[model samples]
Target: MTRVKQQKPAASPAPAPSIPAIPKPDVPARLAALPGLPIGELKAEWRRLFATEPPPYNRRFLESRLAYRIQELAYGGLRPETIARLDALGEQFDGRNITFRRIRHEQRPIAGTRLIREYQGVEHVVTVTRDGYEWQGRPYRSLSAIARAITGTRWNGWTFFGIRPRSGA
Candidate 1:
């Protein structure tokens, strides 16, 4: 029998190295605080929308229901200047209490007439349109539409419907 030569173990290749994955912080939380639509884009869109669509509503143009009721009374014709002033009151009072009044002419019946004014117990002259709902002869959709024209913001509809108070009011 021939003598067997001692066999040496071959060096094993180094085990493959392992890599660790890095942890990442959550991103959605930070973005959540921002408005979904960018401010610039919203303004641009609003301008475009209003420029193309005719204004269907304007508080300055809408004759309140009370005003329309008062206009039906005797001696209802109003001067142009008075009409202009009353229209601007929406912007000033942010829609104050509206009222209707009867002015009976005890002495001069020709000059005396009923008056309808926004806010309680005011003598302001507010003329109502035939349908009693037009702004600058154009149909108005809501008091909020008028508010949008004046304030450049989306106002809640409840206020115009006379069902709810303004957000802060």
Candidate 2:
């Protein structure tokens, strides 16, 4: 009677597989390829800006764009009409597309007027600097320079382009 019941063996559980940790960003690409500014100057300013969060005028955008725009303004200046157009656009960049790197701080700075341009395809981040000017930061000094970096190719994001008035007035 004791041996009447048949015993069943338990199934073994599967072992968990290991996952890899996130890789660190390539410092060279991050530091080397600036849109229009000199490498040394950009490095110095990037160091200064990164330590602190985006100031008033930069706060509106995500951390990366805000950081990027600060670099842009150091090289190029924005245009007055562009600023007016942005206001008129009121969150619209032409009828079909729109993006923003807005001022999101305790007190936004008055840019007076800042130019906006589409370099590769995306909206180039533009902003006014403390010394009073606009700037752009994308594409690096050369496409080769950008290619040598992590992307292994040219970056197609916005760049600091010269201001051109909208025609057909």
Candidate 3:
């Protein structure tokens, strides 16, 4: 009988260390829980989600930002086109300059809004238009002009109409 050298069976390769699959985050639940989380917990969550330190903002700000971040991570962020459009719009208002001058959209009422103000004993109605303001069927370039025509005196139109003061007052 020829002694055939039989090679021992090759040792089986060690199985890869079993890695526990990370669970998908439940976005809605996380968002809902943000409001109730304590400040320290909220900061912890912010750090975990953003991988950075939380901004030194108010509780409401942190909660709102974290909620947005949670949803963004789960469902993906804004589309590129949307982001570009937002940047373009912001540039229009920001002027892309160091001395930033923001156009106060909130202070200006929407076009077609009828501003009714009583001057002395008479009521005056000014209609906001796309180009400017329409007062008594006449188009005025500036609210101050309209205010002057209404009261025969110089006045800050926004203040006169009870709109919030300008950025620098």
Candidate 4:
């Protein structure tokens, strides 16, 4: 009688490596003291954390940036690819640098800037102010309202005034 040897089963594939968890840092309460800090003190705090001179901006701007920097130091900032993509997007938009916060707000024409449009063979001019747009010597809330007044229908002011590119463009 021939005795057969038992064959071992094939080895299974190795398991994937698990990612490690990141530890949270103990942030100082001073990070939250934005509103009350004086302008000079806020800039000093920014210099201490960033090791660079702060921009010449208002107190609220300085505080918000300092808070963001503090958090970025604790957590990771944007990836290089994401930043590159954003830079490309900024260039696409008339080669202007775009910040993350700027995306949250609508683009505004500078004060004293004028926007002209023609609707139904009539000329219309709107002047941008520090607070809002002025049309026909009347202060209005938004460009859309101005556009609606001009077209007698719903319209986006920026699009109507060529501030934004046309659709499909």
**What are the TM-scores, per candidate, against the unseen true structure?**
0.18, 0.21, 0.47, 0.43
Q: Which model, 3 or 4, shows the larger lDDT?
A: 3
Clashes of each: 5, 11, 0, 0
RMSD of each: 29.3, 20.0, 18.5, 18.2
> lDDT tens string, model 1, 1-169?
9999988899899865432221223223222322444544433333332333223444322223213322322224467888889877643543442311111112111222222333333233322332223334454334445445444678643343333322432
TM-score of predicted structure 3: 0.47
- lDDT score of residue 25 within candidate 2: 52
At residue 102, candidate 2 shows an lDDT of 28
Q: What lDDT, from 0 to 1, does candidate 1 have?
A: 0.37
The order of the candidates by TM-score, greatest first, is 3, 4, 2, 1
| Candidate models: Cα lDDT each | 0.37, 0.41, 0.78, 0.74
Instruction: Give model 4 RMSD, 1 decimal.
Output: 18.2
lDDT of 2 by residue, 15-75 (tens): 5532222123533354344444554445444445454433343322333453444444344
lDDT of 3 at 47: 79
Q: Whose TM-score is greatest here? A: 3
Which structure among the candidates has the greatest lDDT? 3
